[model samples]
Target chain A: MSMDFGGLRAVDRLDLMIHRGEIVALIGPNGAGKTTFFNCITGLYTPTEGDIHIHPPGGGSKRINGLKPNRVTELGLARTFQNIRLFQQMTVLENVMIGRHCRLRSGIAGAVFRPPHTVSEERQAAMDSYRILEKIGLESFVNDLAKNLPYGAQRRLEIARALATEPFLLLLDEPAAGMNPHETHELDQLILRLRETENVSILLIEHDMKLVMSLSDRIYVMDYGRKIAEGAPGRIKNDPVVIKAYLGEEYVA
Target chain B: MTPLIEIRKSVLVSIWFMFLTFPIMVIRVNTVENVVEWRWHNMIAIGAGSFLLSFVWRYMIRRKEQGIRRQREGAGPRLSIFQRIGQERRIFLPALTLLAVAVVVFPFLVSMYQVNIMTTAFMYIMLGLGLNIVVGVAGLLDLGYVAFYAVGAYTYALLNHHFGLNFWVCLPIGAALGAGFGILLGFPVLRLRGDYLAIVTLGFGEIIRLVLENWNEFSFGPSGISNIPRPGLFGVAFSLEAHARYIYFIVVALAVFTIFMVNRLQNSRIGRAWLALREDEIACQAMGVDKTRTKLTAFALGATWAGLAGVIFAAKTTFINPASFTIWESINILCIVVLGGMGSITGVVLGALVLVLLPEYLRAFAEYRILTFGVVLVLMMVFRPGGIVSNVRRTYQFEGPDSGDK
Candidate 1:
């Protein structure tokens, strides 16, 4: 997929793919268009050239290009922001419940009158959101406002919120950016467990080399908005082009 | 930050304001007399006014800084005395009962003029709550809200004038028409937000008022439809005092109904969508909320209450013209919602009472009333940026369809 802003090519004909139940990592330098690539695929930006397709498990593949971000989410793709976009004023559970908005079907009449179906649906939404929080070990902060959560917990809450949408493909943008070693380790376990237990595919953009190498099933490296190398983490770690562009040459083994 | 420096700054500010007002305040030209009147006293007053006001402004700033410091130190939010009373059920219940009793015996305690004023206050409470849905919960800045009120009032007036419909018959029709107009406005302004949304809505209100003024054939042009009979009981007549009391009860019941419905809607799924939308548009959309649908619903629902209030307004007054539905009318309702606490039902009610009744009771000092009102609003914003009672966020209890499910 390609994305352009005016005369600048933000993501230049980027070709990337993810299979079911795989943890794929996109590694790149600053301005390498990693987030832009994610945006293009998730309908935050419409790709100028390439088609974006999603094939939900047991469902036919369909193009999602030019769909609204919410429509993309409805098609089984969800993402967490690099800067953490959880609604700050809302309680943690409400943050997760908002993620369940697309899946639930209720309107003004249901909200005002509280019909049987609306009640059941609301109950189900709350339960599901609570369950996601519990699985992510954030049930303790359920009633706390999102802004009041500690930095690490706020980041984890974003993941939990994204999970509430029941995505087939989960995209995390720099999930380990500011985390301490222990927190990053926990996030690694959480991402792995999400795939194993939730049956979801993962794609992450990260600068933490140790976390990236340890977590990714495959690594794709990019420089100047173009892919430089792609292989198993071990092979990509030693690739000459990847080392020259991103990973320092001395780190190659 | 020292007091001396602050004093110096204030002197400069006062001088700047004096200079700014020089053209109009110091040199006022009398167009009819063909002479310019140099009112040096006006300049002196402004200079003295701003100089004294500047000290108060500095004091408020320091106090606000202290608040921020306290918050950063994790003292947590200090609940005001009003909030504490609200939390204490013992105090709240009896206070509520006392207020209810006062309302019940109010007409007997006061003259019909006061009763009518109280009735108008309740009508404003309903309008405040209605606007709260769109402005407070949905975070949609609607400035032309009076247009919907105008629709509701005129719906009754025109219906009564053309077809001889009664207030009771026109109430629901007015509400429906108001909602229809809300949707009509919603479609064009759905994508606009913040000040832009406010501007468009403001213009929409002006358009409605101007049309009412100019379209003589359709609306009888500004002289308006009067004698639109007050809402009546089943062919029964009453003394003027009894009728005023009856209208008071009607409005009180309507206000209660608005409170009930608005309270319910604010905690439901759609309400959550609105709150989330208010919090973040992109995140809300990414969460799969259809922004268009959510916005339209907010407009329609908010207008529903406005429509209801409008019908009661015409009935209570027995007259309404385009003059009754001015930009200032819209601003008054907006003030009630904002000063009351945007999403808080309690805040809106108290705000309406304070804003509406305080001015009425202070009629003895009519000249100072507006000045006092302005000072109070600025003080409120400085001390409690969240209105008189900020909305407390809702927490859902986890007990739905299946208990303890996987």
Candidate 2:
């Protein structure tokens, strides 16, 4: 898919496909348009040229080009922003509960004068959100305001919130940007556990090569808006184009 | 800094205020009487007020910073006074009981005039709480809220004038019409935010008032519909005093209902959606909240309350005019939502009472009401900008997986 803004092309004629439960890392230099690509797929910006489609396991492939961000989420695609666009004033539980919004059916009548079904649905959503929090290991901070969370916990909360959507595909932008090594290690484990247990595909944008190499089943490297290399981590680590554009020559083996 | 420095700074502030007010306060041209009046005593009052006010401002600022500093330093979060009261039902219940007793007896104990004033206060409380849903929780800065109020009022007036419908029958119809108008306003301004949204709503309020003023065929062209029947009790006739007391009870009941509904809504699924929408539009949508639906719902619901209150207003006054539903009415309601505490039902209630009633009790009440309101708002901005009360979220206790919903 190609996305152009005025004279600038943010994501150039590129094609990406994720299997049902594969963990893929999209590694690129700054402004290489990984986040832009995520935005395109998630319907924040419609691709200028190509089509975006999602196939939810048993469902037929449905085109999602130019749909609103919320509709893309409803189509089983969820993403976390590069700068963490959490509802800062809300509690961790409420944040995740919002992720459950598209799945539940409730309107003004259901909200104001909740019937038994609505009540049960709300309770189930909360319980499901709490279980997601437990899986992501943010249950302790469940009641804390999103703004007050420590940097690493906030990142995990974003993932936990995304997980609450029960999406078939998850897009995480620079999820480990501010995390310490220990926290990164934990996140790697969490991502793997998510793939194994939650049965959701993950497309991550990461700068931490070590975490990326360990966590990703495959890596797609990009430079300036075009995909430069697509291969296993070992192959990408030694690619001349990737070395010149992103990873230094000295590290190329 | 030092005590001496603080005093010097306050002196400078007082001097600055005096200079600022010199032209407006100290010098007044009497255009009709043909005299240039110099009121020197006005300068004295201004100087003294600013000097004392400056110290209080400085102290409040320091205290606010200290609270933030403590929070940042990981010094165990300190709950606000309201939050503490909410936590300990012992303090909350009795305070609630006393207020309930006061509301129950206030009309009977007071003169008809005072009861009438209290009824007005109740109307404002309803307006404040309603606007609180839009401007406070949903984070939509709607300036045309009075448009819905106007809709409610006109709904009752016109329906009664034509069909001879009474207040009780018109109440729901008025509210539904208000919600319809709300959606009408909501659809156009769905994409707008902050200042832009405020401007559109402001324009909307003007449009409604203008329509009422010029619609000679329908609205009677601003002379207003008068002699509208008071809300009757199963067609029972009453003395003017009895009607006043009866309307007071109806309003109080309605006000209490609004509070209960608002309180319940603030904790529900849609309430959470509204709060989410208020904080960040993109993030809320990404969480699968339909932005269009959420915005419209907030508009419709908030307008619903204003409509309910507007019906009561027409029945009480036995009159209606475009003048009553001006933009200032919207601003007055907005101020209550803001100064009382956005997103806090209790804060809106407190704000309505303080802003509405305090003026009536003050000396030279009519002349000083606006001035007092301005000074209080300025002080509030400088001091407790979050409002008199901050919203405290209800926490759900965590139990093990085996346990059911508690």
Candidate 3:
């Protein structure tokens, strides 16, 4: 699926498919419309041109354009922001718990009265939040305020929050943007583990070519909102257009 | 123990002992003619109370530090549903039960003068809770909440005095009027945020009061409307002759009901939405919260409570005046919400009771009362910015989709 932004063509018509259990990275130069494509897919912007389809686990495809971000999330697609958007004032656990809000059925009456069902649902959500926190090495920080975490931890917390949403497909925008080399190396491993252990599809937008090449199963390169190249990471690494648009032609093999 | 630790422990014990002794001392020393003398006793009691309280406070701080250390060592108490529920229940249920008991028996234990003071306190509680719904939960600063109060009062007064409508009949009319005014106020300021919204709401409140004062043809001007009927129980007046205490009971009932509803709303989806808005409006919008509708609901719900309080206020006083609802009144209610701790129901209740009842309790200090109130509020802000109950915290957990967090 693809998106068009008026005559400027921010996200030009492009076809892409993300299979289950695969990690795909979309990379390009600045103003390459990589993030714009993300915004369109995440429902922050509606595609003026084409249809983006999401296939749920139950064997049905749903058109995702023009839906609200939360509605899109409800259909089993969750995302992390380029800049961390965890609820800062809430605790780490609370931030993750909010992602489970779509699944929880305890209304106002149930919360106040706290009946059997409410208790069980709340119990389940709490357990789920803890498991995710544990997975992200954030179990000890469960009670810490989101804002209190170190920058690297904050980034990890954002991913943990997205994971808590229970999406079949996770969209990550620049997860390693501000990370040091060591942290980025660790994040690469974390992304690989997420795909292998969790068995979820991932669509990533990254500027770090090394990290992208190492982690992605497939790569789609864009320039000025148009897909300039698409192939396996090895093929895309030497593609002339991809190198010219992003890594500079001189660096191409 | 180290000398420092020993001192802290001593201080904590003393403060706890003093808190336990305070009410007993107050009851023993309270006198009709020399209420200001009671203030000195309070000072002594608080001195002793603080000594014990500080020790406990220090101990708790140390305990928290130890807990954090344990967490870093992977030995902290694992997050559990039972434990979380127990913690919340411990904080909420006891306070609730205490308030419930107080409301049930207050009229029987107090004199008529005390009953009147209690009624006024109840009004302030209603106002604080109402404003809390907007400012605390929804994070909307509304300086014009008093306008809704005025609208409700005027609605009841005008309808009752001019058309001979009963108090009960006019109560709903007053609520409807307040809700209408609230929605109208919300529309114009929907795009405004933070301090800008505050200024507009302040102006809106002032505008309402000024209109009520100047529009004599309708509001009867500064003289205000007189002979507004009091509410009756099943058509029976709760007067001095029949059962004056019944009116106090009614006020107590209304206060309790308001507390119940506010607590419920605070825990519901709408309550969560309001808190989400308070934390971050842009993110709330991104999360699909209808900003305009959420804000309007807050205003309307808050106004509805204020209107109900107005009914009680009108009926209790049996008279109405534009002077009753003023900017100062709004400030006082706002102060209660802040002093009690924003988003804390129990905190607001305690704050309202103390702020409203302290003046009546210290009638002899009438000249210095406002000065003391101002000093106390400033000190509270400086020393305890999170209000009286800062230690209370909320935690959340999320499990994976396939395997529930539990």
* DockQ of the candidate models in sequence: 0.49, 0.62, 0.22
TM-scores of all predicted structures = 0.89, 0.93, 0.74
CA deviation > 4 Å runs, candidate 1: A247-253, B1-68, B397-406
- RMSD of candidate 1 to true structure, Å: 4.2
Q: In order, how many clashes per candidate?
A: 0, 0, 20
lDDT of 1 by residue, A1-253 (tens): 7888999998887888899999999999999999999888777788888888889997799999999888999888889889988899898889999999999998778877889998888878888898899899998887789999999999999999889999999999999979999999999999989999999999999999999999999999888889888989999887789878865667656
For candidate 1, write residues B63-94 as lDDT tens digits.
Answer: 88998899789998777667787779999999
TM-score of candidate 3 against the unseen true structure: 0.74
TM-score of chain A of each: 0.97, 0.96, 0.95
- Report each candidate's C-alpha RMSD, comma-separated, in the order given: 4.2, 2.8, 9.3
Candidate 2 error regions (>4 Å): A247-253, B1-3, B10-81, B363-366, B395-406
Least well predicted 10-residue stretch by lDDT in candidate 1 chain B: B397-406
lDDT of each structure?
0.89, 0.89, 0.79
Ranking of models by DockQ: 2, 1, 3
